[model samples]
Target: MAQWLAAQPKTIVVQPTTLCPMDCTYCYLLERHLKQEMTPQVASAVADGIGPSWEPVEVVWHGGEPLAVGLTRFVELLQPFESLRQARRVRHKVQTGGGRPITDAWCDVFEQYEIGVGVSIDGPRELNHHRVDRGGRPMFDRTIAGIETLKRRCIPFTVLAVVSQDGTGQAAQVLDFMRDLGTSWVGFNIEAKEGANSDGQTPSIDHARQFWRDTFEWCRRNNDVTVREVSNLLGFLGLTQERRDADSQHDPIPTIAWNGDVVLLSPELLGVRSVTYDDFVAGNVLEDDLSAIVQRSDELLYVQEFTNALETCKQTCEFFSFCQGAHAGDRFFEHGTFAVTETDHCRNSVQAPVLALAELLQAKGSR
Candidate 1:
């Protein structure tokens, strides 16, 4: 627990605004309708809270749709980090829905800041129908147009696709679609029940396991576009086999809400309200130092319970070394508590991929 408190967050997720153009069915942001934007004061407080770090820190501009704040207002929000950026101590990244609103000015800002952009497009039209506009219209064409704009401007960006049950079976198609869009990197996020969307359906453990296996095989053959999940699993498994102390180090990741409220660990825990813990909010950047907030959160009962669960996992679970107890938000949402280990999320996301990759290696050895 001391090490956890001492660990400085490498990334700070900043939600600029709750407003969004599209209404993805499985979105975790329950308050997406609210037009609330993070105040400049709040932004300044976040900048001050983070202060100086020895290593480069990433400020991820995330939201219902970060671009929904518009290009001009977005630049204004980034003003507080300019000094840090100039010093090469901090960098900016944005996770956007890649709707119809992207403009040349946005690309200029991206180039100026060297923002690592990640566009959220769930493959082609058939797969992306779930991520629709407010009027329930598919945004595939508009999203692709935004991707084209980024490409034309010579901006390298990553694609993040949310895999639903409907789209999980089409691994080859998803791979081809992403490659055709000219993205060098693709990350898949499985739909989970969280925040306001408790009814969201996750593919069955078996289905998800098969999907990952198929996806990994396809990516292995293609070798051009990087599949984030498969690559990460392979890296962790391949590297950590010789290192015993890998699971002991836990880095805190702070998520700053529109109002300056900070939540440690999973960013998905920020906006979510729970009967047991209220809202997992450690503290506010305006009122407390980041170090103080993290220390205080260590005293929280839920945090303690989550820590205990992770310790148990370290002792009990075979994949604990690679996964490091997995994401707390998923545990709370799926199993109603963090004291438990191995949810369906774990099976599909971590365990299944690991098993699949190992089997592939075994087959190669036999051959």
Candidate 2:
């Protein structure tokens, strides 16, 4: 079997805790309510696993509401990685729900660390109804208040909006709302079936295509906030096909869960398990070196299958430039394995955006 792409981690998605305050419909974490916070020892062990690598690493303190770990523990969690930060070996980022409180204290720490913040907010109140509290109450106002706090403190942030059926129709409106909310960049994630959040309702490819087209048109008119999808495709369009293919190398994006368990490739695959592949833990940080896990990532049974699938995508798919192999989680969740490609996710998020961007750019050039 062909080996997976050369494995060096570009991003380490650290799940500091599984304790999220708000429950979002699109979220896939099975144990979001569990208070399985990462220990300082585990965090240190993770840092130690890297062993003073000079290559810049992005340490993303990812989901299950990283802020819900409480301010003190949250600060304590960063203690181990201080050396990496000081050495400029790693840059820190946090993707928060923004459903919890974002006080001056949070902003203070963010400023001190110079962390890049990305808030999970789906535009305004109407677009944000999917993310609610445990009691099923809408968290739009609360989330907005937290974002407002960040703005007041002069802390810059990016917004990640999940495009639901409603969002697919109102792309311009959603983009406008997020821009008005003062986000530096707006990233739109398509609602997909993954983990425990599958309710069978997902946006159709036709509708999703429309959303991308509208987003591209809106971006042409208003060049204020960068629409991540549009920007990505635009960059890809600028690149020669040879360069694009060469740049499609899939790095092992290791997601270290609260308990030191590592899931590679797809961060959304952390809590998910497959009978064919077993639990997708490449290795545990406490038991194995991070490099060792990454080295063996290409040899993993599922990864070997992914190698085949990605080969197919590279050969057969027209829009492989946009998403590489799309996402393994989407393949496993939607079609039950990563041994094949052409998932609904690829069509909606990858192909649609690429097609829309190409057509729009061509029209602009002609004009």
Instruction: Identify the candidate with maximal lDDT.
Output: 2
lDDT of each: 0.82, 0.84
TM-scores for all candidates? 0.95, 0.95
lDDT computed for candidate 1: 0.82
lDDT by residue for model 2 (231-336), tens: 8878877988788767356767889999999998788888777688889989999999888888778768878878889889878877765677878788888888
lDDT tens digits by residue: candidate 1, 39-116 = 888898888777454367889999878998877788888999899889888899999996536678999999998899
Model 1's TM-score against the true structure: 0.95
Give the range where candidate 1 is weakest over 10 consecutive residues by summed lDDT: 240-249
Root-mean-square deviation per candidate = 1.7, 1.8
Residue 291 CA error for candidate 2 (Å)? 1.2
The C-alpha stretches of model 2 lying farther than 4 A from their native spots are: 1-4, 361-367
Error of 2 at 341 (Å): 0.6
